[model samples]
Target: MKHLRELTSLPTTGLYAAIGTFDGVHTGHQQLIQAMVNQAQKTSTECAVITFFPIPAIVIRNIQTPITLTSPEEKAALFEKLGLNYTITLQFTKEMAQLTPTEFIDLLVSNLPIKQIWVGEDFTFGHQRRGNTTVLSQLGMQYGFETIIVKHFLQNSEKISSSQIRNWLTSGDLESANKALGRPYSITGVVKHGDQRGSKIGFPTANLAVWEGKLLPASGVYATFAQVEGKIYTSVTNIGFRPTFVDNEPNAQVECYIHNFDRNIYDLPVQLFLVSRIRAEKRFESISALIQQIKNDAAKSEEILKHAEFQTGLLTGSTKTAP
Candidate 1:
């Protein structure tokens, strides 16, 4: 898919467009995107997604903590997999947030000949959150475009949403979060050098340097698939401070022990797709106790991975024990 960073760079040809913050690009967001793609294909018109970065909420609410489900790069990859023709990432700024509903629509309408605009029922936009599906249709008429509203994708009688998924992660509800996401929630980072404490303890782990603003699941041990150097490994990951080894850690540390594998992977990029939570992280009474717990976690992770469904194309690498 062709990705453009600015509205000015959009093509002049008429297109089917899906617009939203789409932070997680979760299953709810997928419905609207897929509908646009399907219609665009049937009509032989190009389709594009106009999404905002830093998400409007972080800018408008001045949220300081990391709350994103997927990074911009990851979201673009998902859109491409959904068969989008173009992906437009608009930088969210205070100035852009102040635009009136008409002004915002004008900017989009002028840049691209949008034939139809697809959005979820809960979608809204413009200054002070005044725009809604109703406003969109009114504006669509004036701009000579059709507004298509896709129903919410729901689970357990509740609409699936990014915020709800974040809540699930915070509460250590990996299964529900994964269900709404339509896949396991994942984090990508570069493996970095550490104190080799895991190595000393005989359970060597690759320390990951994750983005400061990336949202992480609750502190615990998890069953995960670690993608490294084009190979997938069944792994057990720990996402918390090593309370037994360190004092006063400023941030959570992510480290994973790739089962049945050993190699020098420092500085290499790794993506951890969390399948399920194994246990909560706690300080063991002794190093030996910690070693015993890790062994148990590894066995449990292997069993969980045996039947877990992996996202397609992500398993292009070896699904068995990575060398």
Candidate 2:
């Protein structure tokens, strides 16, 4: 897929495009993208995906509650996995927000080969979200294009949405969140050097420098995987303020202790995949008590992974792409 940042000029005229923030690229997004791709193939047009960076909320009001499910690079990768021909990353800015419904459509029509457009039923755009499907459809008629409003994809009578996934994550309901996402709820971050407390205790952990404003699940010990050096290691992750040391830290930290592994990954990047929440974080009476709990957590994490039919989302190798 061609990842584009700036709109230059029209390359071709017959393109089928789906436009959205597509944070999680969750099941709902998968359904919509599938529809777009199917329509594009049937109409002999190129498939395109138009998304934004920093999101609209952050760009407009500076309200950053939207815990991004995927970064810009990761979003493009997912779109590529879905076999889209073109992926455009529009920068959401104040100027872009000022466009009226007609003007927005005109801009896309003028710049992109947008023969057909796909949006969700609840999709709103143009100047404080004044444009709705009705306006979009009218513009489609005026501009000689097609407007398709895909209904909200539901799972078990609940709407599958990125917001819902965020709520699930905050609640530590990994199963429900993963169900909505069609994959494990995970976090990717660069390893940051922390107090070498874990290593000193023979349980060296790779501290993750998670993106600011990204929502983390509840404070707990979880069965997870440490994806480092392109290898998946079964590990126990503690997401909490380390109470055993009695520090002044209030923010919850993600610390992954890979079993029987010792390597210096202070500045390396790692992806931590949460398989299940093992137990809530607690303050042990002493260092020995905390160490014993860590050992038990490691053992439990290994057991959970050992019996799995496959590691979380093809840890060894992934051969599948989007449907």
Candidate 3:
């Protein structure tokens, strides 16, 4: 797929496009994108996902905390995996937010030969989110294009959304979140050097430098698959401040001890897929106690991965792009 940063030079035309933030590209997003892809393929039209970076909510709502589930690069990779011909990352800015519905539609219409626009029933856009599916359809008519509204994808009567999945992750409900996402919830980051406390304890961990605004799962020990250098390793991951060793940490840290591995992977990118929550993070009484718990966590993670079927989505080696 051609992952373009701007619409200035689109590689192809006659586009069947879906426009959204598509934070995690969860199950709901997958279905909608797949539907568009299927129809685009049948009609022999190039398809694209027009998404915004720094997401609209962060800019409009002035959100101060980390809430993104996927980074722009990660989303582009996911879009490519979904068989899209193009993944356009629009650089969202405060000035762009001032555009009216007509202006926004005009911008897209001016850029490419958009044959059809696909969006969810409740999708909104334009200044102050005044534009809805109805407004989009009207604009489509004016611009000589078709608008398709996809129904909400529901699970137990609740619509699967990025916000809902965030709540699930914050609550440590990996099962529900993974079900909604159609894959294990993952965090991708570069490995950086940390305090070497884990090494002293005989559990050397790869400290991850995750994106600033990305939301992390609840503070806990989790069974995870760590993808590094194109290999998947069973791992025990911790996402929380080490209260036992330090106090008042400024941010949550992700540290994972890969099982049966010993290599200097610092500065390399690693993706951790949380399989299940083993236990909540806690302050141990002593260093020995913490070491013991780490051993237990590793054993449990190994057992969990042993019985679980191999998962495929979003892993580095498993990803494929449209031809």
Candidate 4:
């Protein structure tokens, strides 16, 4: 998909546009995007997604939220997967934030033949967040464009939202969160050099230092899957400071020990999909103690993988251990 960084540089074409931070691109966001696609197809217009860079939460909070479910690059990839024609990532600025509702719309819609706008039911925009669905619908009539608002998606009578998904992730409920997201939540990062303590203990792991502003799940040992070079492997990941080893370290870290896999993958990018939490991070008093704990962790991970394999109906012709 074409990424237009500046709204002013957007070409003049009648486009059906969906707007949101689309952080997780959860089920609710998908509904809106699908609606936009259908509307664009019916109207014979280009389908486009208008999202923001440096999401408002990151800019406003000034705290790096853990490992994101998807990075900006991943979000773009998803847009392509969803069959969008163009993706616009607006560089949000303080000046843009100050624009009145009408001014914001005028600036965004200017020089572009926008035939329709799609947003979620609770969508809001403009200065001090004054723009709401009511204002958007009113402006659509005034501007001679159509507006579509998708109702919030409900699961078990509760609204499925990014925040709720975040809550699920924080609570280590990956299955439920994945169900709400319509896909697995993943964290992408490059392998980094660690203390090599795991290797010394016969469980070599690839340390993954997450990107800035990425939202990470709670600190725990989790059954996970890792994707590397387009291949998926079941693994166990530890998401926390190595409390058993480095009790004084302040920052938490993500380290994954891929089961039945051994390859020189240092610096290679990998995506980790959490499947389930096995246990909370804890401090072990001795190296032997930690090693024993890791063995047990690996055993639990193997059991979880076997069950997952059965559930997914993955055929394993042979147990070829990775080297």
Q: lDDT scores for all predictions?
A: 0.88, 0.82, 0.89, 0.79
lDDT (C-alpha) at residue 105 in model 4: 80
The segments of candidate 2 whose C-alpha lies over 4 angstroms from its true place after superposition are: 64-66, 309-323
List where candidate 3 sits over 4 angstroms from the true fold.
Answer: 9-13, 312-323
Candidate 4 stretches greater than 4 Å from native = 8-12, 61-68, 309-323
Which of the two, 1 or 2, has more lDDT? 1
Candidate 2, 1-323: lDDT as tens digits: 78999775646767888989998788899889988888787877888888888788777787856367778877787787777898899998999989898998898888876778999999999999999999999999999888999999999998898888888888878889877877677788899988999989889998999887566888899988777867777788999899888566767898998877777887888888787899988888999988998988889988987764333431234422111
Q: Write the per-residue lDDT of candidate 1 for residues 216-294, one digit (tens) a residue.
A: 9999999999988777888999999888888888899999999988889888999999989998989888999999999
Ranking by lDDT: 3, 1, 2, 4
- Candidate that would win on lDDT: 3
Candidate 1, residue 59: lDDT:
94
- Provide TM-scores for the models: 0.96, 0.91, 0.96, 0.90
CA RMSD for every model? 1.8, 3.5, 3.3, 3.6
Cα displacement (angstroms), candidate 4, residue 143, comes to: 1.9
lDDT of residue 209 for candidate 2: 93
